[model samples]
Target: MELTADQDDELRALTTSSEVSAAVGTRARIVLWHAEGRMKKDIAVLAGVSRPTVDLWLGRYAADGAAGLFATKPGGPREQVSADVRSHVLALTRVTPPAETGLSHWSTRTMADYVTRTTGTPISHHWVANLWREHGLKPQKQGTFKLSKDPAFADKVADIVGLYLDPPGSAVVLSLDEKTQIQALDRTQPLLPIEFDRSEQRTHDYVRHGTTNLFAALNVGTGEVVGDCVPSRNGPAFLAFLKKAVAPHAGREIHVVLDNLSTHTTPDVKAWLAANPNVHFHFTPTGSSWLNQIETWFGIITRQAIRRGTFASVQVLVRTIRAYITSWNTDPRPFQWTATADEILAKVRLTQLNIKKLVANNTK
Candidate 1:
């Protein structure tokens, strides 16, 4: 069997491309070997198939050229699922299940059963699951988001992000926040050391020794942290920590980026700002605490130091925190802010538009 130049190239691609399935590639090889003037028995050995299989594919190629190689044998007619049923399944999956069903969300099994009973169409959970995958639906997962209500949100974002991206010469920019109510928890039983096949284990129950609050300031340029474990989180505590945090950068102008908390705007804080003209405070938008870079450091400290430590007392926890900060400062790595203010605003606007459309649809 002789192949046209196009047919030869196409067949070679099917046999060599990683994406082509093994079965299809093997069939392509059989056709190529036949076109190469190889005997059916030799082609069968080379292609790892019976001599009859080679004849079958060669016959197909003879009849329809290269296209016949990819044609699948017909499996007969199947029971067609109505378009209305598919639309109904998708619509149900997108909303919360009815209160009568005692379900907060719809599962594949429950959705299938409900559709079967209501539509009088026999459907399996497997079919419903496939439909969900095709539509990129995942009922098992959830995400959280909050829209900032601060009227000056856009301006505040520009100011903070500007400071992050391009700070003034000889100025120190600090992302400051307080992690409140850090509990010093002690396990009831001793922790079990990890073995060859077992993970390290600790008691599920723990004794709460005491709680402490941590006030932290992250220097954006150097990534060094200035933190203190205070007995309480208040205006006075915050002001004291602020003084300590800025002590090293005494001569330089300081730009402190912080969240909008009640303690942050107290009369005493305002008085301190008035007393020190060099220190400026920039508040993030309300309900948008994530704009501060210090929060990222707080998460890292929690995962590494405090979460699994056995603290007999708050003092022990404090010491542990101090040690961790000291270790972090020795080789600090700064967190880089890459998103531009315009990019952030664009995404926020898109989110707002989507939320508006969602609310309008629900009302209808």
Candidate 2:
């Protein structure tokens, strides 16, 4: 292990410097010891390593200088699974299993079995799981989305977004919607309250009393809600709610943002709208109820009031809902719409393009 002046200096520096790794420093020290005319057995004992390790590093330095000492090679044998097998596995994950396969989604065991049966290659389910994880594929889970196809989508979006960004002078902008079929479900047994070291529990079974429809009007500017519970959600029920809900702000111009439900557009409601000249209705685009702010309020009530509540009857449920609305109005905070029309339209266009490309690929 004859060393150049530079190689000797570098090895000395590595042995003393804190920056170099312990493994590399050990190897450097081993070579330096060999250069000092020490036996491989002596160097191994001094460095707390085996005689073979000392010989290995000394030979590496002799062959490739400092570069050889630091070069790393993969230690294990070649992969048992071929490249074609991995490619076939990945491709299968991205497609639906054939009907005859009797699979809804590809589990590790099912995919491993299918691969071995179809391709005559033996593989384990653990190997399949590891490969899928490495490639960031999750065939068992899915997400959801809705695409709006209304012809007047652009105009409807502009109308709703404008009301949120800028409302008419001396007017109230209200986002109105109905949460229907709220069930009054009483558990068969009493709920167990949370204890010191245990979680709350409830019975799996319940007694269904009945259901009710909640008609809610959210003042976009103030975040205050005018809400009422009705037995049904129809044109007549909606008109009745509107008359009572907006009676307080009678003289002022009212701008209401609502979804494009059939009841909202019926001739009876349209006639009532025409007669009320001061009240204006802005319809959100089809399949885009998220644009209506009242839907946000509905989600809050469902989670906080109805979902976990134990109501013996529909009357109790309605009373509980009214109490939540009253409390909400006490400290109302306006919901802000941040995205501009251009930003929204750009996102929609990109999603549409992606969906079209996917459809085209699937058809081919």
Candidate 3:
């Protein structure tokens, strides 16, 4: 069986190419051997197959070149799950289960059970799971979402995002927040220092040396942080930190973005804001402390300074926190906001719509 030049080159390329499937590569070799005048028995021995397999491929190549090799029929039944059943399962996954179903989210077993019960089709959980994989559906997992119910959500988001993206000329934008109840914990046993092949380890139990609140203000332009450990997260502590935080940028207009904490809206805080007209307060929407950039700074301090520290006393904890803040300000990089107020509002509205649908379905 002599092959055309194009067919010969194609078979050779398929045999050599790394991406060619094992079955296709073996067939190509068999065809090449037949073209080279090797007997079917010899080709089968060289290709690690029975003589009939070599004869089959040689006949296919003689008849249709490379195209004949891929023309084999599928070996199994064409249908397992019917089209209607697949559509029904997909529909069930896309919506919340009714209250009578007693489920907040659908699992593979539960979905299979529900489908079998509703449609009289006995489908296995594994099959349901495989269907989900094929369709990119994950009914078992749920992502957290919060849509602000605050009436001033739009205005607050605008105010904070505006200060981040385009601050007033020559004004300082500061993100302020408090990390409360940071326990000064000492490990029950001394930590095992990291070795050549082992990681550093610490005991699960610890001695509590009391807790402190860390009040911080991050300058958006310079990324410098002004902060101190306080005894409480109350009106007094916040006011004291406010005085220190605003002192550096005294002559310039200072816009502070903070969460809607009770201490931030107290009578004393309001009076202080009134007295200091140059210092303005912009509150983030309720339950949305993630909007405040200072929280990122707090996360850094927690991971680097406090999370793994062995502080025997509250004073040591306070000192360690102060030292970290001072070290951070040496080479601070500011946090920049990428999402606009409009984008945020659009997402919140979409989430709210989805949640409303879920609630309605739950009620039904």
TM-score winner: 1
Give the distance in Å from residue 193's predicted Cα in candidate 3 to where it truly belongs: 17
> 1-364 in candidate 3: lDDT tens per residue?
6554345556766665565475776788788667656788877776789998888888866544454565445565543887767877766676556558876566565688888886677886667766776776654333124456689989998888988999999999989998889999996532221211112211135889999989999999999999999886789889989999999988999999988788888999899989999998898998677789998788778756786578999999999999998899899999777999999888787666665654464455
Clashes of each: 0, 0, 0
- Over 4 Å off, model 2: 1-144, 189-203
Q: Which wins on TM-score, candidate 1 or candidate 2?
A: 1
Over the stretch 1-364, how does candidate 2's per-residue lDDT look in tens digits?
Answer: 4554345555666665565476776787788667656788977876778888887888866644444456455575544998767877776666556458976566566788898887778986667766866876655432123457899888888888888898888899999999999999985532222211113211125889999999999999999999999998999999999887788899999999998788988898889889999999898888788789998888678656776578999999999999999899999988888987777777678666655554464455
Q: lDDT by residue for model 1 over 37-119, one digit each (tens)? A: 67899878766778999999999766544445664546755446878678777766665565578765565667888888867
How much lDDT does each candidate structure score?
0.78, 0.75, 0.75
lDDT of 3 at 244: 95
What would the TM-scores of all predictions be? 0.61, 0.60, 0.60
User: Candidate 3 — which pairs collide?
Assistant: none
**How far out, in Å, is residue 262 in model 3?**
2.8
Deviation (Å) of 221 in candidate 3: 1.3
Error (Å) of candidate 1 at residue 288 is 0.6
TM-score of 2: 0.60
Native-referenced Cα lDDT, model 2: 0.75
